[model samples]
Target: MYWTERILSEAETRNSGTESLSEGMRVIIGGATYTFSEGILRQERLCREEQEQTKEAFGFKWKKRDTYESPSVKRAHREWLLKRYFGGESSEIASLLHGRENFLDAGCGSGFSSLLLFGDHLASVRYLGVDISNAVDVAQQRFAEKGLPAEFLQADLTDLPFRGPVFDVIFSEGVLHHTNSTENAVSYLAGLLRRGGMFLFYVYNKKGPVREFVDDYVRDHIRSMSDQEAWDALMPLTRLGAALGRLQVEVNVPEALPFLGIPKGRIDIQRLFYWYVMKAYYRPDWTDEEMNHVNFDWYRPSNCWRQTPEDVTRWCAEVGLRIRKMDVEDAGITVVAEKV
Candidate 1:
C-alpha cells in the first residue's frame, strides 16, 4: 500500500470512536502528498523551546550528513548496532526485522542509521521515519535517491500522532536521552507497541561523578551557542582527544577507586580522561571533522540525559515492556525488549 493510505488507515484505527479527522484532507510534505489531520498539525506545533534547540543542533549535524555515510563509518556503526542490539549476527537481525509489518525509526536523523542497520530489509516492512528536526527532509531525499520506499514525518516523540499499540517494531538509537525526559519518551513509545512487538533503543549511561560534572558544565557553556559556533568551539576538544590518542600510552591502575567509578585494569590515557573527566571523542583513523562530529553530538545538545542500568530496567517495566536483552558499555546502555 502507498504511504498515505497506510498512515491514514492507522490513524483511522486510532481515532475510531471519535469523529474522523478531516477525511479527504491532503497535504504535501517533502514533495510527497500525505493524508493529514488537524490533530497532527496541532501536535506538531506543541514543541518546547529546548526541543527546538535540540532540533537545531541535530539539524546542523545531520545536514552535514555526508560525513556519516562513508563506507568505513557506516561499517563501524552497523557492526556496533548488530553486536550491541541484535546478538552480533546478520541472520539474527534479519529474523527480528524481515517479517515485521510496521517498523518505526524513532528519532531517525537523516535516515542513515536505519539504512546502516536494516536498509536491506526495508522492502519487507512499512518503514516510517520520525524526527523533530528538518532532517526528515534530508531523510526523505536520501531514501528517494536510493529508490527506497519510506515515509518521513517531523514530529515530537513526546506527543506523537498515532495511538495505541500501532507499531510492530520501534528502533531508537541514542535519541531518547535528547528529549525532555528520557523516561517519559520511553513510556510513550513503548505504549505505541503492539503486544509481543519489540522496542530497541540505546541511551547514554550515567558516567562517573567527575565526568558527569564536566559534561554538564560544558553543556551549560555551549547551550547558548549557534550551531556553527558550537561546532567550531568543539574542534579544540576533538583535537585534544586526537593528540592524546596518538600518544599511544597506557596506564595500569593498581587499585579500583570505587568513589570515582574507576576500575583497576590497564587503560589508555585518552580513554581514562574521556571516561573520568570530559568527553573528547577520539578515533585515530577518522578525520578531525569526523571526531569533532562525535564531540559536538555529546556536548552541544541541551537535553542529553544519562541513566543508570536500574533506571533503564525500571522505565521499561513501567511501560509494560519485558527486557529480552541488554548490553552495557562505558558509552551507554543498549536494550532489546518486548511489550508484554
Candidate 2:
C-alpha cells in the first residue's frame, strides 16, 4: 500500500473507530513523512482519522476540502453555454494568474483545474499547489504525467513558510469554507499578494434549497462518517425515496386536479430519481463524478457552510482585498479581488 494510505490505516487503528484521535495522523510521501500538528484533529494521527471520517475532505494533506473534478467543467458551450461559472472564460482569468508569473494556486487538488485554467496565462507561471496530504504526490505525478511545469507543497494555508509577497495572482477554487478560520484564510491570502496582485476565489452561497440541505448534512455528522457509514447512510435515503416515488398514483384524466392540464397525481419516479441522485449516482442529469460529488458532499465530515454575497464582500473588504468581480453559483460564491 502507499505510504499515505498506510498512514491513514495506522491512524484508523490509533483512533480505534473514533472520529479522530488527539494526536492526529502522519502521511509518508516522497520518501519522507510530513507531519501536520495543528489542532487536536490536525495531529499526525488524528488528522488522518478526521480526514477518513470525512469523505469529501480528501485533498492534499494541508487542504480541508476536495479539489472538485468533473468532465462537465471541460465540456463545450452546450449545457454550460451562457452559464456564469466562467469556466469557459478561463483564459481571461489565467491571464491574471500568468501576470503574477510566480503565483500560489491555493488548494490545488490534482492540478488539472490549474492546468486547465492558467496553463498559458503567463509566459512562465510557477504554480504552487498547496494541500495537507500526499495528494501533493498525486498532483506532482499528474504534472509529470502530463509534462506540465508546476510544483506542489503539503502545508497549511495559514502558516505558510514562504517569504514576502512573491505572488502577483492567487487562485483558490471551491476551497476556504472548509478551513477552521475562513475569515483568517481570506486575510492571509490577501497578505501574500504583491501591491497590485489579484486573487480569484470560488466559494458557495448561503441560499438555495439544494445548497442549504446538503451542506447542513455534511457539517453536522457526515464529515466524520467512515466510507461504509456514508454508504449506509445515503443508501437508505435513496432506497426510501425511490420507494415513495414508486407508490405514485397515475392519473389519466385531463382535469385531474385543475382546469389546466397539469400532471399532479403521485410521486414521479423521474423527479424522485433526480432528487435522490442529487444526494448520489442515479440522477437524471449527471455523470458519475457529479453523482459521487453530491453524495460525498452530503455525508463527508468537512464543514461546508456558505456565505451571502454581502458577507463575502464584507470579509474581503475587512481583509483589504478589493473585489473586481463577483459570480454567485447556486453551489456557492465566486469573487475575484485585488490587493489594493
Candidate 3:
C-alpha cells in the first residue's frame, strides 16, 4: 500500500482503540494538539525523539545563543554560510525570490536558519517554520520574543498539512537526508511550491567508501548511547578534527578521480584529510561547545543518507523542478531548484 494510505489506515485503527494510542502521546506545546494522520503521528514520535536527543546532545544555551546575538553577527554568519555553501553566485538564490512573498522553512531547527536568512526582512514577508519536534516550540518562542511576524507549526515533512502550490519559496537545509525516504520527502515538498517558486536545500553528498565506512562504524556503535555517553565517545573525533585543522598542511594530487569527486589540483591538507580521510575536523573559530554540537549532529542521528549530484539532479527532474543551482561541497550537495 502507499505510505500515506497505510498511515491513514493506522490512524483509523488507532482511533478505533485496537492499540493503545495513549502510549504514543507527546508533550503538548502551546496548549495545541497538532495531530494529523496516524502515519504523521508515528513520524512525529520519531522526530520528537531524535530532536530531543539533539537538544540534549547540544544543550539549550548553545542552540539559542545565535538567535539572540547582535544583528551584525547574525548577518555576518548568514553571508558566510551563503558564500560557503552557494559560492560567489550566492545572491542568485535570493534574487530568484525577488517579488515572491510566502515562504516555508521545512525542518527549521531552533529558527536559526530562518533568522539568519530572512530575519532582516521579517516585516515584509510572511514566513512559516515547521518541524516535527518540540523544536518548533523553541522557534516560536524565540521569534515571538524578538517580535518577528512568523508562524511555527509542528508538522511532519512527509505529510505536511499545507495545501499544494501555496508557497513561493521553501528552504530546507541539512534536513531531508534524515527522513524515512529522502526521495519521497522531496517529491512531497516539491508539490507545495507555487509555479516559479524556489526550493533550496542542503543534503549529504556521497562520500567515498573509506569515509562512509568510518561514519557508519562510529554511528552504529553510538546509536543506542545515552546523550552524555554519546558526547563522551565522540569527543575524541572532534578533537582530532581540531588538531588536523591546526596542521596547516597542503598537498598536490596528480589525477582526477571522477567517482570520488576529486579533481587533480593542489588542495589544503586539512581540508583533504577531513573530506577524504576523517570527517572530524572542527572550525578554528568555533568554541568547544559549538564543536561538540557538530560532532553530536554527525554521530547521533539514526538516518544519514548521502546522495550524489546525479541523484539530486534526477530527483529534481522527476518532481518537475528545474535545477537552478547545484553546489557540491565536502559536507553535502546544496541545491536551489525552481518549479518548472
For every model shown, the clashing-pair count is 0, 30, 1
Candidate 2 per-residue lDDT over residues 48-81, each given as its tens digit? 3334433234542223223234455344212332
lDDT at 46, model 3:
36
146: Cα error in model 1, Å: 2.2
Give candidate 3's error at residue 206 in angstroms: 0.6
How much is 94 displaced in model 1, in angstroms? 1.7
Rank order (by TM-score, best first): 1, 3, 2
Per-residue lDDT tens digits of candidate 3, residues 1-340? 1222322333322324333334444333222233433223323343445545543443332354542355554556687557744674555545655888877888886777767766556555677776766566667677878888776655666665444577888899788887777888899999989999989898988887677888888888987788668877888888877887788777889998777756789987777767776677466666555666666777777767888889989999999999877887768888888898
> What are the lDDT figures for the candidates, one per model?
0.82, 0.55, 0.68
Q: Model 1 reaches what TM-score against the true structure?
A: 0.89
Candidate 2: where is the Cα deviation over 4 Å? Answer: 1-56, 59-73, 76-87, 120-123, 208-215, 218-224, 235-290
Cα deviation of 327 in candidate 2 (Å)? 0.7
Summarize candidate 1's per-residue lDDT along 1-340 as a digit string, tens digits: 3444545554533323544446535543323343444222213363687677888889899989756777777888889888998777878877887557788899988888888888768878888888888777788888889888887767777666565778999999999999999999999999889998999999999999999999999889988889999999989998998999999899999999989999999999999999999899887668888888889989988889999999999999988999999999989999999999
TM-score of each: 0.89, 0.65, 0.77
TM-score of 2: 0.65
